[model samples]
Target: MSRIRIGAGRVTAEIDEQGAELCSLRYGTEGQPGATELLWQAERAWPWHAPLLFPVIGRMNGDRLRHDGTYYAMPKHGFARDRRFTVARHDATTAVLALRDDAASRRLFPFPFRLTVGYAVEGSRLTVSYSVHNPGPGTLPASLGVHPGFRWPLPGATDKRGHTVLFERPEPAPVRRVEDVLLLPERHPTPVRGRTLRLDGALFTDGAVILEALNSSSLIYSAPGSPRMTLSWHGFQQLALWSPPEADLLCLEPWYGLPSPIGSDGEYAASPGQFHLAAGRSRTFGFGVEVSPAR
Candidate 1:
């Protein structure tokens, strides 16, 4: 397993080859230390730091996908996070990892594609970018997303609920929830009150809070006198917030796709939030996070 480190100013990040995942992000300088942890440590509650979801996001109904006339079984969130990525480039404050389709991937996706993930640090902000290239002669249908779990209480909150998420703008519309832990073809009332949603484990009883049509591209996770983190994304169509009520973490996810809908045609291409790319074409998506020092 290979891991690369990148840093600039007060921000430092560690990326792992196993998943091309950002395993650690620390803020502040050395000496008179005032270090802060911005990313969760993979634990038994959920053994993932920040897993990049590619080819597919969330689960396919019955773990199956129908393309053309045949049905193929696919694992939840596809397989990119479990595969090792080759380090294509690395420097003091930047790194890039690449994953290419092979026989193994073809069995699941049946398309020739390449996924490149880049990480860079500047001051207290870190930017993550993804590029998807369709190299085959046919259209490529796929999804991509970023799932990063931050410490629930942050750096100074007294309790998890003491922390809250502030949207850049108010979301007055109802949201959707997964049924029985599976995606449903309906929308439900959102738990957010105007622009702020307080953090609490009980709020996840029905799973993640999935919001679409977000008018804002930025979000703030913070608590009184605590280190505040801002997550900004562009070109993402949806967002999902989740964490087990019993766990001390909160996931702020930016997604281009969601789980396969229930009671629908099993065609993977028809899945909600799926993207299509013509042969030889490429698409790019990105998000960044800036963490301020603890108060």
Candidate 2:
């Protein structure tokens, strides 16, 4: 439950070590009324600031994972968020947290790996990076994603309708969804027309809006008179926007994989978006958030 603070100029952030999560971010110069909250308070239905998804992305059929020759029980989104991560290094502008595969983790995941997460604050932008290394002799198959929730209408805004998500390019692909957290094979036409989606809480009543094979790597969130945040990512294949029904926050997620498609074979290796890491090899995935005054 420890926290690390980092800042650059007028922008500052707080990272919680529990989930190695970014708990808070603020824009505006110090000692002024200009400071505004850019992150949600984890209120309402969900009480997490930012949860890192690893080993598994979404719900597995019956919460079971078939690997090698046995079936193991795995919870949705894996165990990374609930597990404690050790602080590898921390300073004024950057923090590095590390989690390693242990005996207990092996019983659940059956893989030997090391996960390192780093957070850096540069001016009005915060960069979050993840590196996973497969230390064992066998290949490691896993899914990774980032789920960070921002204030829907932002600070001082009264109406959620004033907020909107603007993509870097048009997103015309059919939007996929989940039924009880397991991804449904069918997809609906994207609601985004001309790269924009007007904020509406009702759209998330069932679950998240999943966009597979996105054409854009960046998206902008803005509301009238609020400091807008731009989310940019690389090495991610899917994007999901989610908000619990009536919740005041919207989660913009970058994912490398998705839940098992409908009627999956129940084999982990056959899962969609699962990354294979050769023994002793490492892979990195990252995303950044830049905050600025809305124009």
Candidate 3:
């Protein structure tokens, strides 16, 4: 239950060591009477604030990972979100947490890897970075992702239907969907009209809407008369938009890997969009969030 706090300017963030999860993010001037929380506070509907996804993005087929003719139990979204991370460094506006593969993790993943997460705040923005290293003598097939849920309707907005997401560019490619946590092979028409997506509760009736081939690296979320948020990413090729039906939070996930496709052999390396890191090498991915409170 250990937590670390970091802040700069009008933004402050709280990260928990249990999962290196971002538990809270708020924006307000010093000594202000009201500071608006931009991140979701876990509620009865969802029990997580912002869980990191690693070694795998979504569910493996049958909730099992197959490697070299052996099957190991792997839960949905991998095990990183449930493991503890060691605090590597901390300062006023930055903190770094590290997680290394242990006996328990190796039993599940069968690889020796190191994962480091860094959080930094400056002005009104919070940037999260991830670095994964393969130390074993063989290639490591893995995935990394960030799942941050923001408060829907924002602080000053009354109508949830007024919210919209504007992309940096038009995303006309067909999007993907999931069935029972496994990815469906069929492609569906994009919900985005030009560069804008009108937020609606009905949109998540099935599950997350997965944009496998995202064209934009950044997007803005806003509602009339409410504070606005901008999310930008680097080294992430996929995105998922999700919220429980009628829930009060919206999750914007940027990912470097995907779930095992339905009807495929349960080979771990064959999972779609998996990254193959060579021994002694590393890869990094990151995203940034900037919030502007209503004036």
TM-score of each: 0.96, 0.96, 0.98
User: Which one is best on lDDT?
Assistant: 3
Question: Of 2 and 3, which scores higher on lDDT?
Answer: 3
Q: Estimate every model's Cα lDDT from 0 to 1.
A: 0.87, 0.88, 0.92
Task: List the candidate 1 regions with Cα displacement exceeding 4 Å.
Answer: 30-34
Q: Rank the candidates by TM-score, best first.
A: 3, 2, 1
**Tens digits of per-residue lDDT for model 3 on 119-216?**
99999999999999999799999999899999997888886878999999999999999988789989999999999999999999989999988999
Better of 1 and 2 by lDDT: 2
Better of 2 and 3 by TM-score: 3
Can you give the lDDT of residue 24 in candidate 3?
92
User: Which ranges of candidate 2 are over 4 A from the true structure?
Assistant: 31-34, 263-265
lDDT of 1: 0.87
Count of steric clashes across candidates, in order: 0, 0, 0
Q: lDDT of model 2 at residue 28?
A: 86
Q: Candidate 2's residue-wise lDDT over 1-295, tens digit each?
A: 7889988776888988887888888888854677777888778678988899988988888887889879888888998988889999999889999999998787778889999999998888999999999997999999999999888778768778888999999999898999888899888999898899888887897799999969999999988877788999998999999998777889999999998776675679889878999999999999999988766
Residue 127's C-alpha lDDT in candidate 1? 98
lDDT of 2 at 233: 96
